[model samples]
Target: MRNVRPWRLVAAWVIVILMATTVPFPSGLIETGPFPFDKVVHFGLYAVLGWTVHRAVRAGGGRRPLSILAAWAVGIAFGALDELHQHLVPGRDPSVADWAADAAGYTAAFLASSVLARKSSRKEQR
Candidate 1:
């Protein structure tokens, strides 16, 4: 395992925090659509979070399953907290659907990371 840069992990976490606090939509910036756009946004955001956490953990010398598990745990927990925070915002309300999307994103990322890690290990062994 390569050494994980602490700064990279810190930067990833900072991005997550900024994203959580930033308003979802500003007036007139973008009109709401009939489609479920917010769910897509939640999935994408949590996907990034999961990827970053996975990278951070792998850099710290964690094994494949452990790294993936940690990332998923962190991403899901953060998503829950983010939803809770939105409840306090005047224009926003928490939704379980959003959290489900977040979990799905994290799960997808974790599975992909695990597959890649296994492939890498196989190649290294050859």
Candidate 2:
């Protein structure tokens, strides 16, 4: 994949930047009081983005399924690390609930990728 397609990199970075801006970063402003949906947001956005980058990098390798799983796993670890970082942030206190939400997001992404791969594989046979 040319070590990294410039456009895909830009896309990924743009996604990351967009997500970073949108997600709550904890300004300690009024304490939204434990967002239940944050974890899902973490997983849903990151997993797809990570999988997209992985697929882009390995497009012709015929190894997308495994790569997608790895992307989700990496995202899980990242979510954990992210939560930890939040703990260190001045306005944010880390919560395991957030991490659980993250996992749920990853699972959702994984299922979505699997479905896509399955349909594509079937198309290839037809």
Candidate 3:
């Protein structure tokens, strides 16, 4: 893992997301249930994507704020694109709710990472 590159992780994750979104679900595969499990899945996936993008940006010498912004921009833009791409897939319809979940998840992950990093830096200084 020591030699593993952060950008590689980001690219791999991006590919996974792209493949997942590109595939069309079978008809009747997804139903609007009492609870939306798919939103949770979208959130979790975007969270990981956000974290990876943030790490990659930082590893590439981006400053903290810049890294966070880059992660947010990439995550949200990708989410929007994913939603649009779904329109072309059979049995898939774009939803604003799903995009909202993606944005929320990305923001939560990046902010949490930033807070944790600041805390760890303070600890190291002490």
Tens digit of lDDT per residue, candidate 1, span 1-126?
466574377476657655665566453233256657767877787776666666666667777566557666877887788878877665677779878988887677766766786799899999
Give each model a TM-score: 0.76, 0.63, 0.86
Candidate 3 local lDDT, 1-119, one digit each (tens): 33349889988988998898888887545546866788888899889988877666666666567656866787899899999899999878888988998888887887776677678
**TM-score for candidate 2, residues paired by index:** 0.63
After superposing candidate 2, which stretches have Cα over 4 Å from the reference? 1-3, 6-40, 50-54, 57-68
Ranking by lDDT: 3, 1, 2
Error of 3 at 13 (Å): 0.5
* Cα lDDT computed for each candidate against the true fold: 0.69, 0.60, 0.80
lDDT of 3: 0.80
| lDDT value, residue 93 of candidate 1 | 72
Q: In candidate 1, what residue range of length 10 has the lowest lDDT sum?
A: 23-32
TM-score of structure candidate 1: 0.76
RMSD of each: 3.3, 4.3, 2.8
Superposing every Cα of model 1 onto the true structure, what RMSD results?
3.3
Candidate 3 accuracy as TM-score = 0.86
Worst 10 residues of 3 by lDDT: 26-35
Select the stronger candidate by lDDT from 2 and 3.
Answer: 3
Q: Where does candidate 1 stray beyond 4 Å?
A: 6-10, 13-17, 24-35, 64-67
